[model samples]
Target: MLKFPNNFLWGAAASAPQTEGHSLLNGKSATIWDKWFEMNPEKFNNNQGPSDTSNTYEMYHEDVLDMKKIGMNSYRTSISWARLLPDGKTLNSEAIKFYRSYFQDMLDNDIKPIINLFHFDMPWWLMEKGGWENRESVDDFAFYAKTAFEQFGDLVHDWTTFNEPMVHVECGYLYGFHYPAIVDMKKAVQVGYHTLMAHVMATKAFRDSKVKGKIGIILNVLPAYSRSESSEDLKAKAASDLLNTRSFLDPAVLGKIPEELVDLLSENELLPEVEPSDQQNIKENTVDFIGINYYQPRRVQAPTNPKVPAKMPEDLYEPYDWPDKKINPYRGWEIYPKALYDISIMMRDDYKNIPWYVSENGMGVADEERFMNDDGMINDQYRIDFIKEHLEQLHKGIEAGSNCFGYHMWTFNDCWSWLNGYRNRYGFYRVDLNNHFKRTVKKSGLWFRELVENNGF
Candidate 1:
């Protein structure tokens, strides 16, 4: 058994867009997600949209009881900007009251509340205005962040300015994974820069506020692996690292952009429109901590076409091939536990001594309820072992002097995933979405209860 510090946080994580289902609240304007689902329902897996989610907006008190039952000492959730400010200008009173009461419930229940201002749910009005690509949307994000800090800062102690900014840039702009999907790399660069600026602004705002808490950003980081010792493969792996992780990480924690990225962007004429003041803000307003979400390791080989493209530097990495690999028996994600340790070591040594938490990590299994036995319980021993194996690597990272603060799984209860919808379950408690979404504790939930109480497996 590995020992953690006494004050270590043990909980689960969920995003507003994924968990909270009150999309059409009082005077609440639609987010990009709402608009996207409304426009194209076929984009998501199984054509399941984001209209009626887990309904956490209404059942949060019940959910908190579920958290308490599972022995969670901390809870991580995000605030939907559109929920608070429908028009991007006028604040919604009912929305504010709901979240205020939500935070107060967690604090009153002895659960430390971790709040994220933005979690990929960009307001539709802002998206129509070019989202993060336009400089004005940057100002709108700052307004949302400031508003959240001022209103919820009283009860929410830990603040995450943005959730996975790199993902937002890559998915929303570059790779077109999320709403208003665009493939232009220039827009991607601009959006990335604006997201960082928003984080910097939000961090400063939170610090200056009356709320007493820590401000950080959550990044989904995958350890990069080279296929071989060839210089091309190694360089390709480095390129993948620069684009995927270091782009936002360099500026947020180290307070500067990576030279490799800068050179690439400059050559392509896709450099972000950054003001001199933005640089100063990033340098001056570094985060107190960072939240890392790891699912798998990235394996890369040399690009077949070594020549750089006319516009964008061919970040050509040999494509990933996951054939006959070690698989998590009960889930869809490939098992690569070493990536967790490698990522933590990289953060502890390469970057500044920034404390980190496992903001989100869990295997998503199909038919979670099928594992439930006749004893009126779920016997998910595989899921239990999955969590234990990851925690072992996390424990090794901590023992090696990594400044890791906590570990939170992907979620407390089965909730809606973005593209995967409700097909996959990544929770200790399974929610029967078809039958009024009744929450049921799995064997993993009971195991996690003891794990939290013992602070180790």
Candidate 2:
């Protein structure tokens, strides 16, 4: 039998834009997601938009009750910038009221709340003024973060400054998968820099405000592995890791970016100009903890045709799939439970093992009704196996002296994804969209209840 720590945080994670359905209610202005859906509905799977999500905004009381029912001691959710400050300058009283009630309800149910300030839902007004690419947006985000701390600092104790900031930079700026899609390497670099600066400013604000909680940032760390033992392949893996993982991890955790990456960016003239004060602020205000969101490992190989002064990820190394590796047929992500353990050990040995947790780790499946049993409950044994395998590896890491504190699943309920929308469901509760977003606990949900109740498998 595997065991977890006594104070383990058993919970599931959710974000505002993905779970909350009241996108336009009560002075809530448009987020980049809303505007993106309107501009190009075809980009989303099945034309599903944010307006008709799981309706968590209106049904949060019931949702919190469900969380309690599932034996969750903690719940991670985000406050919408667009909802809290609709015009980017004025605070929305209705949003304030809703969030306070939401947090209070979670607390009332004995569930600790972990609130994230930004989760890829930038307000449209901010995006209009160059979003994170503009240095001014850093100050704006700091103001927003301070406002959130002032309003809910007492109710929530665990605050995350940003959730997966790299996704916003890579997807929105370099890959064109998210809102304000632009495939410019310089813009992506700038956006990434400003995001780090914003996090620093927010951390300073949280520290100065004397908030009663810890503040950190959630990073999706995809460990890069070489396809072969060749030095070229190894170099390729290092470069990929520097670009995808260390680009955010080093600065957020160590208060400085990797010198190799900095030199590469400088050589290419893609480095964002860093102000002296920004450097001082970032160096002084590091996070209290780190949130590691591990999904899968990136398999890279020496590029067949590498470019000089590569501008983007694709230009530097070639991505390859390891032979005979298991894959998630539903979402096309590789299943490598060992990657979690590998990351834990890496952090322990190289990164000083700063206190951290598995912030977002789960499987997303499409057309999950096929997994439903005759009793009308989803027999999502696949999800159970996914969780169990990952947990086993996590337990091994813990026993090996990794400073992992908790594990929060990717989501609490079936919610909207950016491009996939509801096509991929990563929720313990099956949501019936046609039936007013009615939720039913799946078999894995029950299994998780037992795991949490017992503190392990």
Whole-model Cα lDDT of every candidate shown, in order = 0.82, 0.89
Per-structure clash totals for the candidates: 0, 0
Q: Over the stretch 25-46, how does candidate 2's per-residue lDDT look in tens digits?
A: 8789999988988898888889
Q: Write the per-residue lDDT of candidate 1 for residues 287-381, one digit (tens) a residue.
A: 88899988777777887765454233355576565564577554445788878888879988988768888898888888866777997687889
Pairs with steric clashes in candidate 2: none
Point to the candidate with the largest TM-score: 2
The C-alpha stretches of model 2 lying farther than 4 A from their native spots are none
